[model samples]
Structures are given as C-alpha cells and as structure tokens.
Target: MPQKRRYKSRRTNYRRKSNKNNRTTIILIAIVAVFVVSFFGYRRYVQYQSESKVEMVQQDHSQFIKKVSPYAVELGRQYGVLPSITIAQAILESDWGTSSLASQYNNYFGIKGEDPSNTKVLQTKEYTNGQWITINGRFRVYSDFRESMKDHTKLLVDGTTWNSQQYRQVIQSKNYIDAAVALQTDGYATDPGYTNKIIRVIQKYNLKKYDEGIK
Candidate 1:
C-alpha cells in the first residue's frame, strides 16, 4: 500500500511539471508574436508618413506651376519669348519660388544689380575655371514676382550692356531645344550642363505645351 501511494504521488508531480512547461511555452510564443506585429506596424506607419510628405511636396510644386504659368504665358506673348523656357528657368532658379532669394527679394532669375539700394548682398555659387566657387554678389530685388518676370523678359529681349545682342539666338530659336542650347552658347549661365539641365526640365514637366501655336 505504501509503495502504491508513493508511485501515485510521483505521477501527480510529473503531470504538474508538464502542465507548467506547456503554459510557459505558450506565454513565450505570445510575446514573440506581439513583438513581430508591433515591429511591422511601426514600419508601416513610417512608410505612410514618408509617402504623405512626398505627396505634399508634389502638390506644392503643382501649385507653384499653376500660379506662374499664366503670367509667364502672358509675358511670352507680349515679349516674344517662350513661356515654357521662362517658366522652366523660374522653376530652376527659384526652386519653385521657395529659395531665399525668390521668397525674400522676389528675384526669380538671379539677376545682379548695380544699385546698392535696389539689391541684396548674398552668397552665391558660380562655376568658374572648371570648379565651383562661392562668391558674394549683389542681386537685384523686385517689388513682386510679376516685376521680376517682366525684368527677366526684358533682359532676354534687350540683352546685356556689354553686348546688345547677347541673347538674340535664344529669342530667335524656333524650338525649346535650340533655345536651351542658345542660352548655354550665349553665356547665360556658367554651369557647363546648363543646356542639358534646361532641356531635361522642359521635357520632364511638358513645358513645351505652353509654347503651342506661339511663333
């Protein structure tokens, strides 16, 4: 009888240990599952935030284009310049009107000024002698973006002081490609890739549509 009772006690203890081990395994599995789910949830949230920011930036760019397109087209009609080129130049020079020079001084074209009162001295980057250089320059200030656009159109039409016909090729070119090339050949910007860059911008944004039916 004593031996049977001892055997029965041992059997009961073994079953208790087995039950405890099974419960511990289940808890561990639950913890691991929760961790995996939380990690993926966090990643999804981050991805969503990134996408939202990209969408906002795209919207801002579209709005900037809409605001400037009409004025650019009107000026192009009046001055015989390509509206597409003008808008592309503004997009590149002003960074969609977000640059400090554009936002503060309303200078979309980075035109220099001789008069101190009508200019703001700022640091600028220039490509010189096969390298980029930083230099301080007095940039022209304008009352508004309209004035800046008008001034830029006039500059292209009238040309610079040293050469009265500097941008003649640009104004006379029949297409945006030739115009872009002319801007580079005519020394509008010091960047070696200015022509290609302008062409790429025009193509990417379908700026040539603005030039439709305009001679």
Candidate 2:
C-alpha cells in the first residue's frame, strides 16, 4: 500500500510539471506574436509620417500659386480667356513669381527680343556657348503685374501661331491640363515636359476653382 501511494504521488507531480511546461510554451508564443505585430505597426506608422511630410512640402509650394491665382482669374474675366490656364502658365513661367526676372522686371512671361524699338533691355541670363552668360537682353518689361497679364492675353489673341481654332478650343475647355497640353503642342513652349509641369502646379494648387465663376 505504501508503494502504491508513492507511485500515485509521483504521477501527479509529473502531470503538474507537464501542464506547466505547456502553459509556458503558450505564453512565449503569445509574446512573440505581439512583438511581431507591434513591429509592423510601428513600421507602417513611420512610413505614413514620411509620406505626410512630403505632401506638406508639396502643399507649401501650392500656396504660392493660390496667393496669385485670383489676379489671374480677374484678368481672364476681363480678357475672355481661361482663368485656370492663365494662372497655370503664370505659375510655370514665373516660378510662382520667385524668379529673378519676374521679381525685378515684372516679366511673368519670358518674352525676349533684341530690337530697341520693340523691346525693353534688362539684365538677364542667356544661355550662350554652353554656359549661363549674363547679358542685357531685350525683354518685354511690364509696368505692373496687371499689365503683364493683359499683354499675355493680347499676345495669345494676336499671335497667329497661338490664335488657331484648336488652341482656342483647348483654352476654352476650362480644363487646366487640356490648356497646358495644348500650349505645348501648339509650340507655346520649348520644354518637353512643360505641359506636365504646368498641369501638376495647377492641380496641386487646386487652381481650377477659378473656372467655376465663368459664365
């Protein structure tokens, strides 16, 4: 009888040890799972923050366009032109009015000439002999920003190359992208990606809202 009692006690001890081992293994597995999930969650959160910072920088760039957009709209209304297109073109040409030429000469559009009778001489950088050569080139200088806008409208309307039906249709579409693309296709600019850049600036700044008030 004593041997049997001893045997029964030993079996109970063994069972308790086995259950404790199983519990320990389960706890360890749960801990590992939680760690993995937290690691991935942290990684995703960091990625989101990085993306948000990039978007904020882009928004800051767009703010400049927004500041000067109302002037473009008013000019368009008076000249019977597309407001969004004018604003996008101005943003593209002037670099949000931060360019040296724009700041000094009020030349939002880089219209150049050499004849004294038809041009205004300004100190500007000209690409000559594969170098950025500074010279006093004849550029169309405006008295103010409003005059620049008016001259841009007049240039578009009177210039035979830009006065085509196709160009007019695209501008009148009231779509900023369409107008920008048309400008590039119609030889309005020499840059290959000029239209895409203009479209990006317009869209990023939400400049299309100016078209809404058009009758």
Candidate 3:
C-alpha cells in the first residue's frame, strides 16, 4: 500500500509539469504574434508618411501654377491667344522663370532673328555632326518679360504662315490640348515632344478652368 501511494504521487507530479510546459509554450506564441503585428504596423505607418509627403509636394506645384495662371490669362486676353498655351510655353522655354536669359533679358520665347544689327548673340548648344556643339547664335532679346509674351502671341497669330488660320480657330475652342497641338503642327517649337509636354502640364494642374475669366 505504501508503494502504491508513492507511485500515485509521482504520476500527479508528472502531469503538473506537463501542464506547466504547455502553458509556457502558449505564452511564448502570443508574445511572438504581438511583436510581428507591431512591426507590420510600423512599416505601414512609414509608407503612409512617405506618400503624404509626395502628395504635398505635388500640391505645392499646383499652387504655383495657379499663381501664374492669371497673368497668362490677361496676356492672352490682350493678345488673342490661349492662356494655357502661353503659360506652358513660358514654363517650358524659361524653365519656370529660372533661366539666365529669362531673368536678365526676359527672353522667354527663344525668338531668333537674322539681322546682326538688332540680334543679340549668345553661346548655345546646337546639334551638329552627330554630336552637340556649342556655337554663338543670334537670338531676339526683349526689354521686358511682357514684351516676350507679346512677341510669342504675335508669332502664333501672324508670323506662322502655314497653320495660322487653324491655330486661331482652335485657340477659341477653350481646349488646351487642341491649341497646343496646333502650335506643334505649326512649328512653334523645335522639339517633337513639345505638344505632349504642354498638354501634360496643363492637365496636371487643371489650368483650363482659368480660361473662363478670359472672355
């Protein structure tokens, strides 16, 4: 009877140890799960912050476009051209008013003239002999930025001999893309991708709505 009681006590002790081990395993699993969830949550938060910053930068660019739109619209009203087209051209040609020529000479439209008496000579890059070569070229210089804008409008309205009529008709359509393409087809820019870039800038900032005040 003494031996049997001892054996029964030992069995109870083994069962208790097994239950304690199982509880410890469960606790470890719960801790690991919590740590994994926290890591993923932190990663998601970082991603959200990065995306928000990008969106804020884009908003700033849009605001800058808005600030410049009114002047472009007024210029168009005075010159009988499309406001968005004028703005896009200036932005493209002047590098958003950061170019040296734009700052110093107000020559945003890159107008060129052959008359040595009136033309200003500047060193610029030109494509020649299968490579880019720097050469002195004569470009039209304006006394004011407004004068450059005026000359750009005049070039579109009267100087273009091929598609002047088509551009004039499309400029009244209130569609920026149409007017941009008209300029491209009429050789307003030397770049083949000029029209697409203008369209992208206009659409990205929703610039066409400003034209409502022009009429």
TM agreement with the true structure for every prediction: 0.92, 0.58, 0.60
Where does candidate 3 stray beyond 4 Å?
Answer: 1-68, 115-118, 125-135, 160-173, 213-215
What digit string (tens of lDDT, one per residue) describes model 1 on residues 1-215? 99999999999999999999999999999999999999999999999999999999989988988988899899888888999889889998898899999999999989998999999999999999999999999999999998999999999999999898999999999899999999999999998998888899899889999997667
In the range 1-215, model 3's lDDT, one tens digit per residue, is 99999999999999999999999999999999998999999999999999999998777656646656777788778766778778778778877766776777788867777777766888766545566777787887778777787777787766654545645644555577778887777666556677899999877767777666565
- Winner by TM-score between candidate 3 and candidate 1: 1
Which 10 consecutive positions of candidate 3 have the poorest summed lDDT? 161-170
In model 3, what are the clashing residue pairs, if there are any? Answer: none
For model 1, the superposed segments whose C-alpha errors exceed 4 Å read 1-13
lDDT of each: 0.92, 0.74, 0.75
Which model scores highest in TM-score?
Answer: 1
TM-score attained by model 1: 0.92
